[model samples]
Target chain A: MSPFLLLLRLRLMEVFRVRFTGFFFLGLPLLFFALVGVIFSSGHPFAHRRVVMVATAADENRSSEMLVAMARFTEIRVERAATHEAAMGKLRAQIVNAVVEPLSDGSGYRLIVGGFDELFGRGLVTALPGHVELAVAPLERWGFVHYAFAGMLVFCVAISGLFGMGYNMVRYRQNLFLRKLSTTRLSKSTFVAAQIAGRGIWSLVQVLLLLALAHLLFSLPLSLVAALWTLGLTVLGLCAFLGIGFLLACFIRTEGLIYDAISSIAWPIVLLSEFFFPADELPSPLRFAAAALPSTQLVRLLRAVLLYGETDVASLLPGIAIILVWIVMTFTMGRFFFRWND
Target chain B: MGFGDQDALLLKVVIAAARLTKRFGSVVALENVSFQIEGPQLICILGPNGAGKTTLLDLLEGLSQPDAGEIRLFGTPLSARRYPRERVGVVLQKEFILDGITVGEYAELFATIQGVKGAQQILSQARLQDRAKTPLSKISNGESQRLFIAAAAVHHPELLFLDEPTAHLDPGAKLEVGRLLTEMSSEHTVVMTTHDLREADTLSDHVLFLVDGKLKAEGAPATLIDSIPPAARGHGTLEEAFFHFCAARLTARGDIEPVRP
Candidate 1:
């Protein structure tokens, strides 16, 4: 077998022997999601939740007035769909809670099957003279639990990248474990690859499980497309985060230093993220700055696919591009400066 | 074992380090340290503490780049791209094993890195088969040391570099490690550094004495012993030999006060 396989196997055995490592990754994020989900699901829900819906009509002018009248609620957000078929596609994809189209007689609107509160949709139904049709029942008792879950999922991945792979490297180097591997036939690339692959496997498994748990707990909806997109985005995000961790590990020696140093980078990304507040509510001065953080990008992109059913390639490119830059920058710097021993 | 593009005829030339110099900022660790090994010889780098023994070994093992020198293994220059890694085993003085794994897992990891099998056989040779499943942290220091030796020697590399294998061991453990090194010398060329004079005297077929980053003397133990004058050879052990070399290097460098008449 290749040394990479051996290293990965041994690492997995070593890490698995300590169950706490796996649990720490799984438990903390699940708890965070549960706490938030429970608070929102029990009674109080988020106020004026922004809902994206696609409106289509034969005449653009008529739909414009309907959009104007609907904008009065401030809770409902709207998007224009080019056709009834387009609106139906978004509604089916959960991109929109419901489609507001002209009635058959073109006199009123009809509420379609959706995953939003009936009462919230009622304001539109009463003004538009439409009846409610339930296709997907409410997944969340209050505000959408999926958005909060996305942030918590990002938290899990960020911690895993920053601490799991990076901290372990520093510890191994300090304890002379890496120096031992260095003398063997183990090449630098193989060693690093093993770390990345192994940690990625562990992180992906936990994240998927957390995804499933979110579905079961709050009745959150899941689809193959959303799960697959989360996987792709997560893998990209992981590479960037792991690269950052690796570069940091190349310099820092102590475990305490690894914790403090990485957390200093990750916590800002998390704290300034929607993790602490709804994305729209981040303090105004820091809103743009927070949106630019890798964690924010990850959370936003993850939220798009998971909750908004946004798998649009063009819309995701900017965030993906920024993450691509991180992946390139961190791994390049890390590979350049990494030493087998401190 | 893999010796990519290495000449088969020159395989016996295990190592040839010429004018090897290494520096740490301003402090010189090893200076102009030249040496050669042409057979499966048990070589000892005998030195006093801080005599650059480990530094020389690091240079030979390709762990650190020498500031000014070249090292050739099997007639191939030691570059990261071309070093005969498959034919070498190394156990650093400050090396450590991941403690969270079983001893078997640790040995298996080494075997896998070298692309060989028989971790069980290695553990058996180390008398650690019974403790294969035991976590590395739970093993005694002696067992840990034996495992280190066994794991490195598992692939039977042409050469093995050990740095102070018996430094912190108790007498029995040291003796056991000494026996292990002796057995290994028969099958593979072993280069080890130590400040323990008796251990060097008892274990090495050839000895290299280093003092203050310089090769003071080297040859068969008998040749070194014979070179010392009978009167100055008090008990005539490697201890006396190393002290003799240390004194000579100091005198040659004018690093010591002139001896009073």
Candidate 2:
């Protein structure tokens, strides 16, 4: 093996030997999710593809906005028809769960639900319009699982990177192991690379395991592309947080302080992110603050693609850009200040 | 294969330091020190506590830059951010060994990064072959130091720096380390710092005596013995030499007023 790879292997072997490492990645998040499920007990019981058809006579621009709003529900799949008769053909054939028709008074589009899921579709009709909270009505048992699973993922990414890479590295510095390594033919860059690369590989396994558990234990729907999106967003978030941890290790002289610092930084991030509540639903400035936080955007973007079926590159730009900047900024600052205290 | 460019191997000179000075905050650790070592032989830097012995080693190993002055290793300009790690090896006074890793893994990590092979052989040479699978946390302190020396020398460095490598060991372990260093000196030019009078007198082919950040005396053992003032004659050679200069330095300081330094 190459020096970097060899070092990375040893680092992984060393870190895994620590008690509760696997549990930290796998069990803790599931436990947190179960806690969330109990707190928010209300849910939509029958989650499946909720295909909605649109009548041609419906108001054009308003209907488009309404479709966008409705699509936020993971179960909703919107389709369009040329005429009312054509829409009814699909609805009668059971291809569409429901169709949106223009109400007699014309205040807004009205739900004309029917199909194999007629009774459940009828419940959505009464729950439509001003009461859009029912958008998650189909999610039923899956609601808290999705929301809390995403929360735990973001939490895990931050904790693993900060504690796993950062705190451990500071301990190495305090023990003078880094100083000893500095005397060998090992360059500082190689050592840092080994640490980052090692943790990065571990992050991959962690994400895959979490996603798999979500599928196996909770029966959360898992599509390959959604799985890929969650993994990509999670690892990107891990890299950014890892940089923060690296930055901490670079300057902090003691392990206890590093531990305290990591906890201080990580907890606030989880609180302000979509971990606890929906950032977009909050008041403007609070929402704006949460929206700007990389942690919030990371979970937000992951949830968008994983649950809501959002695929637009433009929508994910803010979170991806914030995380990328974090990667560059933290690593750069960390490198600038980092030195062996020989 | 190397962290630093080992271009200095082409040059014949082992080390050439001129007027090296170093400071930490307001405290000057080394001041205007100059010396040169020319061949594959053991050289001892003898000093008391706070005498700038480690600071000198730090400069020569390129671990730190002199606040003023220059140093060359094997005829190349030494760097403050030391590189070309293949040419120089350092074994610090206190062993820096990581827990959780076995002795073999520890040795292999250093040897591989130094771009050398046969880590097992290196461990065998250090007498750590039996303990190869033992975790570093479980090893005796003396064994750890010996392993460091063994691992650092795997690359067969042109210049080796030891900072009080035998400081805290028992007499038997100390002798064992002293013997390892003696063997190292025959293959490479080794610079060691020590306060142990017996170890210095036994191991050093040449001696550089330092006192309070200044070079006080430097020469072959016989030459240093001859230079001892007549009043200090037959005071036990090197031990007498240390006391003779230390006594002179102490007497000289008596005329100066005390200052917080």
Candidate 3:
């Protein structure tokens, strides 16, 4: 066998030897996809506002007619109010989206709004004539499923970075394994290539397993081509993060310091990456900072490809560029600072 | 031989260092050091702690570059930019625990690195045949040391460098390792550093002694021992001679720090 291949095989085998390594690469992604699928499939009833019903004794026929009209435009549940006082009581109690009060003249009506259902009230006013004005309490859509999946992807990357590359390299240094390898005919470039190849294979396997589970159990719409693209992007992301791990490992002398440094960098990337929220909603400085992080780009790339089916090269340019820059910077740093002496 | 005929007299001097110096930003590790070792001899370097032993070994092993000096191996100038692996074998002071590989597997791996066929034969030579299936972590320290030596020599290298090969071995294991080194010297020049003067005396054909990064003395063990002060020299023990030499060097420098324990 060729030297590179031999080293690559040994490295690949080492990655597989660790049981948690398998989980980081495979189990976590599968769980993440499954959770996303389940959450998305089980849509929330509260997401759609129910229509409100209002009644008064002055014009029962007019009130009923308005209730029926509101019901056509929203999810309205009709209720009777003997007087204006009773309708005001129902409004205060927020029993309905809005109440229609009949004028004593009987030519028009006033829609008394309640806060129980803000979305229905706005829809009612928009669908009705100009005379009706909406008093709306803004309700934002819940995108928990998207946020959760993105968070899980970021977590997986962090785990792979910390345990897969950072911890492993530190232990190797502490045990003098790297020093011993330095004595051999193995070049530093070849050694690093082997490590990348090993992690690449493991990360590929993980994405495949997750894709399969996502399809089988969660009914995730993972096309064959989409799956392949996800796998490729995941491997690229893994390599970039692992390269950072190696760079961190180079500066720290002891295992304890290595752990501290890796964790310090990793957890913040997780939070500041905005994996759990839309980047637009995140604080401005945080959004800018996260834009520079590889995880943010990776999550964005995965979401675009998997959730949105955006496979065009133009759409993927920014993410690909960020990942490429990260890989180059991290690999260069790792090679420059890595020492066998200490 | 005249200085002009120095190159002609040597039969393949695999390693030659001249005016090699290393400084770590102000602390001098090695100062204007010079040495040369021709092939097919077992040479041992003796030094105490912080005596620049590791730095010198690292330079020779191609693991690091010297700050200012020249190193020539196999008639070619050496530098970090280009590492020539065909002529040299180095057993570093530390064991490389190649993960997910067994003892035999590592031996085979190194055999491939050395471009050697018949890895089993090399394993037998290192006396690690029985422990072939054992994981590297499962093997004893001495066995691991032997395995490293075996791997280094599998290619039949012209020069092999070992740094403290017997540091972790018991008495019996040390003797076994020494015998293997002695046998290996017939075909390959072996250069090793050790704090143990007795091991050096038994296994080395020539001794290079370093005192504070300088080549304090060099010669056959017996000759060096006989030359020591009469009151200090004892029963041909290189250890007694070494202490006396260190004491004399320290006194000459007007420094009173004791020799490393």
lDDT of 1 at B65: 81
Q: Per-residue CA lDDT of candidate 3, range B56-145, in tens?
A: 999888878899888888767787777677767888887678676898898888887666784797689878888889888888887888
Candidate 3's residue-wise lDDT over A1-342, tens digit each?
999999999988864675555555566567555644443342432333333344545466776677666556433445554555544433442323466665556656566565445665666666764366455432112223433454576567666755677788888888877877777677778777877788778767776776676556655556777777787888878878888888878876667666656655665665556565444334456568778888888887876666556677787898989999999999898889887556
| Pairs of colliding residues, candidate 3 | A51-A75, A51-A76, A52-A97
Sorted by DockQ, highest first, which candidate order results? 1, 2, 3
What's the ranking of the predictions by lDDT, best on top?
A: 1, 2, 3
Q: Which ten residues in a row have the lowest lDDT in candidate 2 chain B?
A: B249-258
TM-score of each: 0.77, 0.77, 0.72
What does candidate 2's lDDT look like per residue over A1-342, in tens digits?
899999999877753564444445455567656644543343322234445545454467666776776677766656665456555533443434666755546566656554345576666656555532222113235545666787888888889899877897888887888777777777778888888788878988998998889888877667888888888888788888888898888867777667757866775576568685654334455567777677888887776666556556886787799889888999899889888664
Model 1 chain B — which ten-residue stretch has the worst lDDT? B252-261
Classify candidate 3 by CAPRI docking class.
acceptable
Per-model DockQ? 0.61, 0.52, 0.40
Give me the displacement of residue A28 in model 2, in angstroms. Answer: 25
TM-score between model 3 and native: 0.72
Model 1 lDDT per residue over A235-298, tens place: 8888888998999898877776677567556646665667635444444555677776678888
Query: lDDT of each structure?
Result: 0.75, 0.74, 0.72
Q: Write the per-residue lDDT of candidate 2 for residues B177-251, one digit (tens) a residue.
A: 889989988998889998776789999998998878888778787788888878768755787787676553223
Q: Predictions ranked by TM-score, top down?
A: 1, 2, 3
